[model samples]
Target: MSNEPVSVGDKAPDFSLQASRGRTVSSAELSGRPYLLYFYPKADTPGCTTQACGIQEALPALGRLNLTVIGVSPDPVSKIDKFADKYGLEFPLASDPEHELADRYGTWVEKSMYGRTYFGMERSSFLIGADGHIKAIWRKVKPADHVALVEKAAAEL
Candidate 1:
């Protein structure tokens, strides 16, 4: 499967979705701050949790750089809420149940687990500038040190 990826210097695609914060977050509302938009497979899973909590732990430093962290997954709002609460994750975790945002950003993909191949959301992240342009793109990310990388990118912004 191939997708036309959003790249550095490209204008970020607009989106409006339900976030665990109980708000409909839109690209327009995120215009004034550098934002990190990360897409993961599911809530409360190992790698996804690791990636999310990493961002959570680094939120303070990221915020100091005026960066807003947001996570998107196909899970329903209920699951997203539970995961956020369980982890004390303060960032907005948006629900992309239809994966419109993921498809637009090229995070939707095909994967295999024990020979079961299916379409799914790839673990990815996009750093969007205050001007709404893609600043960086990370694909096939490692959850462990992911947050630190985002923090470093925020520092450069």
Candidate 2:
């Protein structure tokens, strides 16, 4: 399989995943509108929680920008649901349990930690334009500063 990553100006890949909102969130559904598609390592983890809550805190600004946010991870739908419910996350948290969306987005890769290696989803974010093309990308995102970066990008978009 080609490991080429998704880049700015490429058409966003199509996906259909079960989301925490109890329905499928597909690319088609989000078409014709600019949205932030963010990928994290897992649901309910410390870093992921901080990233998610950061976005939640910025929802007012995001809404004013006319943008929607969707967070994707390789966790099961149940886990995503619990995370959202527990944290009162207003955005949809999509389940990518089989890594279909992660693979399609090229965020699933071999990662090394403490001299051990394994495959996992990289923390990344993609800004998709109204026309469905990527406008910006944040690969290996830092949770602490992700929302601010997205806010900047969204303002430019």
Candidate 3:
């Protein structure tokens, strides 16, 4: 990986992963279009569900801005399928079980909880512009406020 960390002005890293419901997406295909790439820790968890549903609720408005949203997590395809079905999420939920994409975006980091330290995806969001450059970045995002922020950013895109 390059030494650069993803930031507002840097080019977004490339990725190709399997999305839920047998759909797949690649950064190559998303090129020339603005999109939101969100990295979460796991599937079917409280925070993850809230974030996904929040995005779900904002889909219509985001569409008006011509922005696409794809969620990434270190979960398997089956788990992502269950998550999407349970929550009725219409957006693509990409599987990143190996943390390949997370590493590229620098979202994977050391986390500590209750004195237990571990490495995991650090709930982050990236807004990639139509020119393939990152327009904005939100690291360690709060789920409750994520969607509205995304909506606002998209509208201005």
Candidate 4:
């Protein structure tokens, strides 16, 4: 890994991953619109639920900004499928089981829990411009207020 923070104005890496609904989503395909690319650790967890639901509820407002919201995680397609159905998540959830996209965005890093250090996906989000450049990046995000914060960022863009 390069240990580089994918900063504002850097070209966002393009990737394709299986969606929770059995389709493939790619950065190249989401042309001519800004997007909020968020990385979460797991599917169906309490914190993750709060974050996803918040975004779901704010979809309309976010749409007015011409932004697409996408959630990425290291969970398998099957798990993500269930989580999406259970929560009625309207936004697409992409699977990155091998952490390729997460690593590329620098969201995968060493994390600590209960005094134990381990590697995991550090919750993060990026505001990617229509031209494929990153407009903003949020690292180690707090799940509860994530949606509101993302909305704020999008409004500024």
Candidate 5:
């Protein structure tokens, strides 16, 4: 993948991934409408949990704005299922264990923590418009600030 992340106005990459509750989500099916693809580092961890739960709480508002939300992670489907079940998250949590989607989106990135460096998913979100072009992009996002930012962007979209 290029060092540059997918930017606003770029066409979103296609994906078909397994999700919680034995569901499948694909870019094809989500076409002709706006959607939010939020990538997190892992499932069920502190920040991830906070972000997921916050988004879960705001689902009604987001749906009212006609924005579909999908949380993507490098976790397996089984782990995603568990995370969703544990938190009662109604939205799809897609598994990206192979990072195909992340690579295309540029969220799978090099990171560092605790004096160590590694590659991982950056906390990011992309708002894709009905025409399939990206409308907004948020990278290295804070979990607490995600929903409000997305809400504002989706409303404007």
Candidate 6:
């Protein structure tokens, strides 16, 4: 895979991730429908929780627009399950424990914190059009701004 991040208008990378509620979410299954795929560093953290709850709160509005939302994290299935259950998140919370999906989506990235370097999932999101092409990309997203931004993009789609 190229090191470059996925750009808008490119066909989104296909993914088949295990999600909460014993579900499997795949790009093939989502074909011909608009959706939001968001990546967060971890589950149940403050920022992640804020972003997730915001998405959950906006689900009704998003549904009215025929948009589905999926939250992706490096956490395992058990952790993702707990987080979704605890927050009462109705949308799919996908586990990317191996980060294969992250890498494919270009959300897996390098970082430095307090003089140390490591790799982690960047807070990012992709708004995919019904035709399976990416309509928008958000890198290093802020939890506070995620919902409104995605909602607008989905609306445009």
Could you give me the TM-score of model 5 versus the true structure? Answer: 0.97
For each candidate in the order shown, give its overall lDDT on alpha carbons.
Answer: 0.90, 0.92, 0.91, 0.90, 0.94, 0.93
Could you give candidate 4's per-residue lDDT for residues 1-157 as a string of tens digits?
5546688999998899899787888988897789989999999999899999999999999999999999999999999999999999989999998888888898888998899999888899999988899998888889888988888889988
Instruction: Point to the candidate with the largest TM-score.
Output: 6
Candidate 2: minimum summed lDDT over ten consecutive residues — where? 1-10
Candidate 1: residue 12 Cα off by (Å): 0.2
Per-model TM-score on C-alpha atoms = 0.96, 0.97, 0.96, 0.96, 0.97, 0.98
Better of 3 and 5 by TM-score: 5
lDDT value, residue 21 of candidate 6:
89
Write one digit per residue (lDDT tens) for candidate 3, span 1-157: 4324677888888889999999999999998999999999999999999999999999998999999999999999999999999999999999998888898899888899999999889999999999999988998999999998888887888
Show where candidate 6 strays beyond 4 Å.
none
Best by lDDT: 5
The total number of steric clashes, by the backbone 3 Å criterion, in model 1 comes to: 0
**Per-residue lDDT of candidate 2, residues 54-110 (tens digit):** 999999999999999999998888989899999999899999888888887899999
What global local distance difference test value does model 4 have?
0.90
Model 6, residue 5: distance off in Å is 0.8
Please report how far candidate 4 places residue 154 from its true position, in Å: 1.0
With candidate 3 superimposed using the best TM-score fit, by how many Å does residue 125's alpha carbon deviate from the native?
0.2
What's the TM for model 1?
0.96
| Better structure of 2 and 5 per lDDT | 5
TM-score of 2: 0.97
RMSD of each: 1.5, 0.9, 1.2, 1.1, 0.9, 0.8
List the candidate 5 regions with Cα displacement exceeding 4 Å.
none
Of candidates 6 and 5, the better by lDDT: 5
lDDT of 5 by residue, 66-107 (tens): 999999999999999999999999999999998889999988
